[model samples]
Structure formats: C-alpha cells, structure tokens
Target: MSNTFSSPLAGRSTGDRLILGLAILLSLVMLLPVLWVIAMSLKDNAALMANPNSVFFPPYELTNYLNIFATSSVFRWIANSLIVSVSMTVGVLVLSSLAGYGFARLNFPGRDVLFVIVLFGLAVPEQAVVVARHQIFSLLKWHNTYQGLILPGLSSAFGVFLMTQFFRAIPKELDEAALLDNASRFRIFWKVLLPLTLPAQATLGIFTFLNAWNDYFWPLISATRKEMYTLTVGMASTQTNFAQSEGLGYLMAQAVFAGAPILIVYLFFQKYIVTAVSGAAQR
Candidate 1:
C-alpha cells in the first residue's frame, strides 16, 4: 500500500497550523478598525448619533459617498492631487535615477562629500525645513501655485539613496559590456541599467506618489487658496461646523473617499510592491 498526501497543508506540523491560525486571527484583528470605519460610513448620521452600535445592525446606505460626490469642488480637489502626486513621482524618479547613476558609476571631485550631504537630508525633519522653504517660496511668489506644491517634494533624499543602492547592486559587467558596444554613459543608463532597476523604481515611485498625495501640512500652508487645495486639504476644508457630532457618517465617508484611490492603487500594484520588498530584503 502506498500513501501520499494530496493536500499540501496536510504535511504541516501542529505548531505550523497553530502559527497559521494565529496569523489569520491577527489579520482579522487588524482589519477590525477598517471594518468599523466602513460600517460607520454606511449608517445614517442621525441613526449613528442615536445608536453608535447600529453600524453592526441593518439599514446601511450609500448616502455618505454620494454626498461626497455631490460637493462641487471634490472633483477639482481630486484633479489637483493627481497632478501634484504624478508630477512629484516623475520628477523624483528622473532626478533620482540620474543622481543615482552619477553616485554609483561616475567619479567626480567631492562626490563622497556631496553624497554625504544628501544623506544628511534624510536626518533633517521636514518641519525643520518648512519655515525656510516657505520663506523662500514666499519670496519667489510661488505660493498657491503647482510649482510650489510639486517642486519642494522633488528633492527626495530617500529616493536617491534607494536608486543609488539599486544601481550599485547591479553587476558592473553589464556597464562594461554596454561600453564595449560603443554605448555612451547616457545611452547605457537609458537603455541598459535603467531597465534593470524597474523593481526599485516601482518601489520609489509608489512611495513618492503616496507621500505626495497624502501630504496635508505642506499644502495647507503653501496652498492657502481654495482653488489650489490638494485632496487632503480640500477635504478638510469641506467639513461643516461640529462635524464629529453632527456629521459622523459624512466624516467617516470622507476618510474612506480620501483613502479609496490609494487603496485601489495598492490593489493594482501589490504584486510589484511585494516583489520590490522581497528583492530589497534579499539584497
């Protein structure tokens, strides 16, 4: 008689099963707050006030989400956010790619010193630089402009660092081979090395986009004009007086609405993100 396990998990030891079960339990526990928020978003504001626990009961509706769309400026805010985030992400990638290549492959006077200066930027808090940046932009009369919003975010030290590491990790033989084929430095970077760094680029781009999109404090101070407000700032501006008590559902709805686009983005690119993270871990 021959016996073999058909189910892969059938081979798992008791401890493995217990660990898997605990992982599932933890995942559900983590999801509880998100589930709560989604539930609150579906309940009527009045009903919620009367009975907060009604979210767990019946009579859910899409009124809160609809109300968000009903607001005239919501679409404008969304557009503004997209523009800033996309622009910043592109700028960061381009600048970082070039800077990374220079740092990784090229030799120049004071290269190490300049790289050290960039690393120093990683330690400097945004709050520390905000006053100076605001003052300079104010002097340039750049406030409430797209340039004001996008330009400041482009100097991404972390993006440069990540790209540099990715470039350095790539085998030098590829660069040498490209050079042997009469390829210039720029050509090698554009056609050879850049393609190999797709994982790192995806990782950097996703983080940069998310950071730019979710940024509120910077936009709040720089984009004082309502027309220039990003989604985060604009959403905050839309809140009516006493929103917590008077419009709990609507408030929760806004949270969901603001977060929904990023969630959708993550769902689409989760595989790439996972791949990037794994590659980084292995490196």
Candidate 2:
C-alpha cells in the first residue's frame, strides 16, 4: 500500500512542478505591462526619453504626482469616482437581490416572459440607450448631479442574472423551512437567503464598482461642470494632460492612480470574487 502511493506521488510530482512553473511564467507575462507602467511612472521624463527602453531601473520621480495634483483636482476626481462606484455597487446589490429573489423563487403572471425580456436586456448595449437616458435625465434636470451619475446604473441585467442564478442554487427547502416558521417571503429572503448570496453580491459589487469607476464616456457627456467630473472623465479632459508637456511618464502615473482603488477593492474581495466567478461558471 505504501509503495503504491509513493510510486504515484514520485511520478506526478515532476508534472506538478512543471505545471506550477508554467503558471508562474504565465502570471509574469500577464503582469509585465503593469509592472512596466509602474516603473515608467516612477521614472523621470528626461531619463525615460533618453533611455526609451529602460524602465527596470528608475531614477525615481515624484514630479508627475506632485505636478498633476498642483495643476488638477485629481483627489476630487478620485472622490467622485468613489462616490459613484459605491452608490452603484450598493444600489445594484439591493435591487438585484430583491428582483432576483422574485424572479427565482416567487410565482407571478408573466414572470417567465418578463425574465426572458430581462435576459434580452443583457444584449442591449449601453451606447444604444445613452441618447434616451440622456434625454430623460436632461428633462428631469439631473444632468450634473450625483443622481445623474448613479441612478442610471442602479440595476443591471448582469447583476440580476447573477443573483438569480445564485439564488436558484440554494435549495428551496430553506424557504420551505422558513415558511413553516410563519416567516414572510421577505423575511425568508432577507434573513435566510440574502446571507447565502454574499458571493454573488461581492461579484456584482466589484464589477459594478469597476464599471462605474472606469466610466469615461457617460460622465464626459453628462458632467459639463469640472466640479462634477469623475476620475476617468477628469483624467481625459484636454486640460489635464501629458498631451504636450507632461509626457508618457506622467500619463502612466495617472493610470496608476486611477487603477489603485479598484486594485485595492479587488484584493480585499478576491476570495469572494473567485468563489462567485467559479460558482457562476459551474452553473
């Protein structure tokens, strides 16, 4: 019995080591551009211009970070990004959970048809709705407000679909148990099932927040005022640039700044993210 196990382990260990090495190599290949960007962001423009190929050893520069801050409202823009992202995440989670539970567990007229319609909604592009959404918001005079930034993204088909799938995976027996205890449907949803949906919630939250944070086009159109600009919009503005003067190093620094929050959020929720994505894939 001992020889049987030892023989297999010896044979497999070499293959396992090879697979692990390849995984590491693939990871590094994927991370190289990001690493280069970090390196360039730390490098001085003159040094980078002189040695265009050299990013590995940096004559580190804080000039870009300082200059951009002095010239632009980068911090305010970051704050705006955070506000929009957090609001969208929270709104999508709440709306998706409620709607998902209704669609997944409840009986209603046209529920199946309505769900199909909602599924079709996933095929609709944001670009297709922008003009209509803009017109409606303009009519409501919400154009420059946080409501303008957040309300349109409160519920997404993707979020609803994800939550619905997650909710379905949970046994109906839990709901039956709650029902026998005189629990209302809402109580069953909130107390018993919602807790189980955390993985889905994390997945939706991260995706929505990243989408909101990285949104450039809608904010560019809606936020006419500089004060209302989100980070992506602010960064893209003609005046806030390495367009002629600040150069590639400065631009890369801005990219790093824009990416930092989402990176932090992803890191914090990474465990939940993996579970959520894997669960969805299995479903």
Candidate 3:
C-alpha cells in the first residue's frame, strides 16, 4: 500500500518542469508590450523621447492618467464603446441562438441552402461588403447612429455556426421530453437548451464584444459625429491632439485604458471560453 501510494506523491517530471518554464517564458514575452505600455504611460514626454527602449528607469509620472481625462473625452469614449459592444453582443447572441436552433431543428424547405449561404458568408471579408453596407446604411440614414454601429455587426457567421453546432450537440431526448410536457419550442429553447449553452454563449459574447470594441474602420467611415465615436476611433484621433513630444506617452496611456475592458472580460470568462472553443471544434 505504501509503495503504491508513493508514486502519487512524486514530484513532476523534468518534461513537466520544462513545459512550465516555457509557458512562463512565453507569458513574460507576451507581457512585455503591456508592461512597456504601462511604463510609457507613467513617463514624461522628454524622458519618453530620450530613451524609448530604456524602459522602467523612472521617477514615474503617474499624472499621465489624470492628464488624459483632463485633456480628452476618455469617459465618453468608454461609454460609447460599452453601448456598442454590449448592444452588439446581446443582439448577436439572441439572433444567432434563435437562427442556429432553427437551422438545426426546423423543417423549412430551403433551410440547408440558407445555412449554406450563411456559411459562405464566413468566406467573405468585411472589406468586400463595406461599400454595399455603406450605401445601404446611407440610404437608411443610419450613419452616425447607434443603429449604424450595432446593426451591421448583428448577423455574424461565426456566431450562427457556434450556436448551431452547440445546439446540435445537445441530446435530442431533451427536446422530445420537453415536447411531451406540452412546452412550446421557445420555452424549451429558453429554459432547457439555453442553460446548457451558457459556456458557448459566454464564448460567443466575448468574441463579438471584442470584435465590436476593437472595430475602427467602419466607425471611422460611419461615425461622422464626434459623439458617435467608439473608443477605437476616438483613441486613434487622439494622436493629433498631442504634440510629437508627448505623443508616445499620451498614446500609451490611452492604449492601456482602451485595452482594460477586454482584459477584464477575458480574465472573467477564460475557463468558459476555453471549454466553448474545444467543444465547438469537437462538434
């Protein structure tokens, strides 16, 4: 008994140690840019220009953060970002879940063909449809509105695919059981199926939010009004607000601010995200 149990208490193998070392090394390597940006944000203009690569040798100028809020509309940009990102995420989840479940279960005549069309959309780049989307939005007078920001991104091929595949993975017995209980289709979907899909939903929500949050080109074109500007667009425009001397620190400070939300989100949903991805791939 002692001999058998001793192996369980043994130290990790050398390969495990090596792998752990590599992972830490890789993490540090990835972390360098973030650390550098933080360092830059804490620096003054003269120090930043004098030794751009000589990072961390500092009496850190913590006022860069305060200066940013005083000099620019960072809070407003954050609000706009949250509005667009949250709206788009919710829209994608609701629309995609319904559409995906329909595709997986409904017996409509052109269902497969339509699903194929949505799949084909994955192959099409955003730049390809930018002109058409622009013209249509222009005609609809959606430009510079939240509708302009949120509507175009609501229909996501990846979202539909992820949800459809996730729905299909659920046992048919659950649906049949719900049917025998006299529950309606939407009731089954909302109560029974959706709960099981929380992981996938989290994954899809993260993806959509990050994409919408980081989106710049479409907003740049459609958001003619300053008030409509998302964080990505607003942050880019800040480059011109600062003099060349102060540009580095100013940009770094704003970059950190802009990146904070996504980091918090990722950290929160990381486990669900990993599970969702692995499950989707298996399906």
Candidate 4:
C-alpha cells in the first residue's frame, strides 16, 4: 500500500514539473524579441558590424540613442501621432456611442436598413478605397493636414457595432424609469445610460486609440510633408535610412521610441480595458 501511493505521488510531481517547464519555455519565446531589441539598441554600429551574433549583449557605446534624438524628427512625429490618435479616439467614442444608442432604443423608418449599410463598412478594406479617398481629400483641399488624417477615421462602423451590442444589454427598466421621471431621451442617455456603460466606452476608446495611433499605410500615403508625419511614418523613414547604413542600434532605438507611448497608455488603462472587453462580451 505504501509503495503504490508513493509511485502515484511521484508521477504527479513529474507531471507538474513538466508543465512548469513548458510555461517557462513559452514565456522566454515571447520575451526573446523584446530582449533582442533592447540589446540591439544599446550596441554601437562598430560592435554590431564586428560581431553580428553579439546582438544578445549590450553595446560598448550609447551613441545610437543620442544620434537618433539629435538627427531625427522623432519628437515632432510623436506629437503628430498624439494629436491624431487622441482626436480620433474622442470623436469615435462620442459619435459611435450616440449612434449606437439611437439604433438600440429609438424607432425610426429605415433605421434597420441604415444599420445594415453601416455594418457593410466593416467588411470594406480601408486600403481598397484609399485612392478614391485621396481624390476626395484633394478635391476638398485637405491633403497633408491633421484634419485630413483624422477626419476619415472619425466614425468607425466597428465602434457603432460594439456600442450597439453593449447598449442592447442595458435594462429597459432604466429607460422607462427615466421616462416616468420626465427625462428627455438625450438626458437619459447622457445621465443614466452613459454612466452605466463606462466599460464599453473604455473598450471602444482603447481600440480606437490604438488603431489611430499605429496606423502607418494611410498616414504615409496621405501626409506628404515631414511636419505631418506620424510616429509610425517617421519610424518607417528611419528604418529605410538605417537599413542603408546598416545601423541596427539606431533602428532599435527608433522602434523603442515608437512603441513606448502606446505601452504607457495601455498600462495606465489596462484595468479598464480588461473590464470593458469582458463586459462588452457579455452584451
């Protein structure tokens, strides 16, 4: 009896060890790139060229970071990115939530048809219609402007869809109670529904902010002037120059710069993001 019990306990211990080992291996696999980037950023051009395999280790020099800040327009690019992303996030949150509430609670002719048409926007690729959009922007004489970059992404179909789903999940009794208290529909939405739907708003805000923040292709095509270039666009330009010069350190530093702001924002709002996504899913 002692021998049999001991054998089963040993087997379970072995199984647990194997599971822990696999988890550690997976974590290292995910972390490798981040570690590599940091290593590359710290290295100098000479070190990188002399020992290409030494990318896992720190550089003998910190000139790469100084060179990037001094030579590149990275700060300007970051400012532009912030302006566009924040504007788009605010616009999407307000417009999409209002539209969503209307679709969920209001009765109007052709509302369903309009909602269906808007849903179709989600299926359409931004790249496919970019040429036409550029032409329209040109006709409106808004090219290379901040408004031009931001206006196109202002109202997203996905935002509407996400908000609509969340709004539908709200109890009808709340609306009825507000009505009985002589509250206007607008007031009801502003005072009651909006407060209760904070999670959905946070979910939508983060998604919209990320989309606007990291967008590269459209910004590259639309914003021709260096003054209007976003962080991603600026990073792309830096990559091209670094590629030509084989400056691995500079490339990594630029990447870090581009990614740091978004990481900070996410960290700050991470709790809300989790709550919002979980709540939205239940809706």
> Judged by lDDT, which candidate is best?
1
Best of the candidates, TM-score: 1
> Per-residue lDDT for 149-244 in model 4, tens only?
999998699999988888888998999999999999999999999888787888788888888988998898889898889989877776664473
- lDDT-wise, the better of 3 and 4 is 3
Give the higher-lDDT candidate: 2 or 3.
3
Q: Backbone clashes in each candidate structure, one number apiece? A: 0, 0, 0, 1
Candidate 4: list runs displaced more than 4 Å: 1-25, 240-245, 281-283
lDDT of 1 by residue, 1-283 (tens): 7675466458799999889889999999999999999999999999999988888998999999999999888899999999999999999999999999999999999999999999999999999989999999999999999999999999999999999999999999999999999999999999999999887888888899899999998999999988899999998998989898989999999999989888887887788789888988998
Q: For each candidate, what TM-score against the reference?
A: 0.95, 0.92, 0.91, 0.88
Give model 2's TM-score versus the native structure: 0.92
**lDDT of each structure?**
0.93, 0.86, 0.87, 0.85
lDDT of 3 by residue, 1-283 (tens): 4565554325989888788888989999999988988998888867778888655785887676786678557688789989999999999999999998999867899999999999998999999999999999999999999999999899899999989988988999999999999999999999999899999899999999999999998999999887788989987776775656656887788888888899999999999989987887776
Screening candidate 3 with a backbone cut-off below 3 angstroms (N, C-alpha, C), the clashing residue pairs are: none
Which rank order by lDDT, best down to worst? 1, 3, 2, 4
lDDT of 3: 0.87
* Candidate 1 regions with alpha-carbon error over 4 angstroms: 1-8
Please tell me which model should have the higher lDDT, number 1 or number 2.
1
Tell me the alpha-carbon RMSD of every candidate.
Answer: 2.3, 3.8, 3.3, 5.4
Q: Candidate 1: minimum summed lDDT over ten consecutive residues — where?
A: 1-10
**Which ten contiguous residues of candidate 4 have the minimum total lDDT?**
1-10
For residues 1-283, what per-residue lDDT tens digits would candidate 2 score against the true structure? Answer: 4444453236567779789778889999999999988888887877777777767774687887776787467788878888998998899999999999999999999999999988998999889999999999999999989999999888599988888888999999999999999999999999999999998898889999999999888898899998889988887773444454447778888789889888999999999999987887887
| Residue 17 error, candidate 3, Å | 1.7
